[model samples]
Target: RLPVRVDVPVEELTRDDGLFLVGTPRGVLRARNVVLASGSLNCPKRPPASADLPATLRQLDSSAYRNAAELEQGAVLVVGSGQSGGQIAADLALAGRPVFLATSRAGRLVRHYRGSDIFNWMTLSGYLDVPRREIVLPSGKLPPRGLLGATHTISLQSLSAQGVVLLGRFMGIENDSLIFGDNLDEHMRFADESSADVKRFIDDYIRRARLNAPPAEDDPAEMIAPRLPSPPIHSIELATSGIRSVIWCTAFRGDFPY
Candidate 1:
């Protein structure tokens, strides 16, 4: 019945019993209850998901490739180096497949690194007066559970040690291969594990804080260090399986085209 309108982009799926949607630059469109299987904002340089395509195409979005080959015969490229990208790339590489990870920024470490997790560190130290604390995280593609990131930091460290190759910057795709703007491969070859020293020091801090529990001295910001660098995403290459899948992982504006 609604053949021609099937191709249009729906701006908003209203909350009413009748699903009301505003079309892109057109007008309002409606359905019973709209389901938003539609992916992120559109870009001209990427491909939509297609089965039998290269996993690299699914892995790296538009930032890496204009289009990817779907035969799965060539190299797989994992874009980005934040916890997700790094983890993905490491998994691919360890599988004995040729893979590459593109990163626009370098990953960082906390100033005071400890073998213990941050939550434990916080409790053992004087950062939090209560046993539990609250944290806020940026809202994104992930489903909303609460306000903050609660994952343990160990996952990132383990991935870095697993041998994921890190590349710097996207220079655009060329010559059937993904390339970088700079030579970061030689430097980021391994994770910074010596950070254990930082962690051990935190253990010492907590021990001292426990002895003074109430207030021997107020905690100073200078005493606690910050996190080390980790890479942020620019773009990705999803064209490894033969079909290029382009995804834009950048921040979005409040886009409404009604």
Candidate 2:
């Protein structure tokens, strides 16, 4: 059995002669082997233009955000369309607050497709177990961020249906207006392509494994249905837009002072 220390805050760590010296509030402790499990989401990132906002506007990052009830009384502008930003914007809109979502090129996946959860197919296909070294992409390119939630598909398209005003990637602050790009069409197309790629992979796996999965039923209405696209907003005047609060959900970084 191993001894566990409770409520002991680690102050410093150093190495000496193949041993680890840990300094804490009580005293210094030594160990032959050490493990560091500090997480990455502790440090939240904000847009570079966040500092230029007026003092009257309230700002909160994803780390400090709790719920829509705590936000100021007015329209809420959520920057970044990642998991946190999407969910928070949906929640706020559902709670009767006008939510404006500034979107980026984060691709999305359906929660369930072909009578199975997408994650189940990912596990069966060994996609989740790939080693980091085997992962490859073009130079200076990164993978798209996936949507967050369980057993339900939520995309910007769905959020737009629920009265969330979707804006393109936030550029910067210009005068009293927030500048945004006009890449809404490209972002939507990227999401659709990503979803199609995943579906194709699943279909190929089913065929190769000779699984007797039934063909997906066709929904004519759904296939022909057209969704109301989110109009691109080039810029938003903060003073005139009635936006009282801003939520920054860009990304997170690791901050280890030690």
Give the best candidate by lDDT.
Answer: 2
Query: Across residues 37-89, which tens digit of lDDT does each residue of candidate 2 receive?
Result: 87755798787789998888899997788888898899999987767787888
lDDT of prediction 1: 0.41
Question: Against the unseen true structure, what C-alpha lDDT does each candidate score?
Answer: 0.41, 0.77
- The digit string of per-residue lDDT tens for model 1 on 1-258 reads 655755565555554565565456577666666555444533322222223343445444433433334315455555445444544454455665555555534333342233434546656665446332243225324321111113323223344344544456555654444445554543243223223333455557857656433322312322233222256323344443332332332222233342
Show model 1 residue runs off by greater than 4 Å.
Answer: 1-73, 108-115, 122-163, 174-177, 183-208, 211-258
**Where in model 2 is the C-alpha error above 4 Å?**
6-9, 16-18, 25-27, 129-141, 217-231
Error of 2 at 153 (Å): 0.6
Q: What is the RMSD, in Å, between candidate 1 and the native fold over all Cα?
A: 12.5
Model 2 accuracy (lDDT, Cα): 0.77
Give me the candidate number with maximum TM-score.
Answer: 2
lDDT of 1 at 62: 33
Residue pairs of candidate 2 with colliding backbone atoms: none
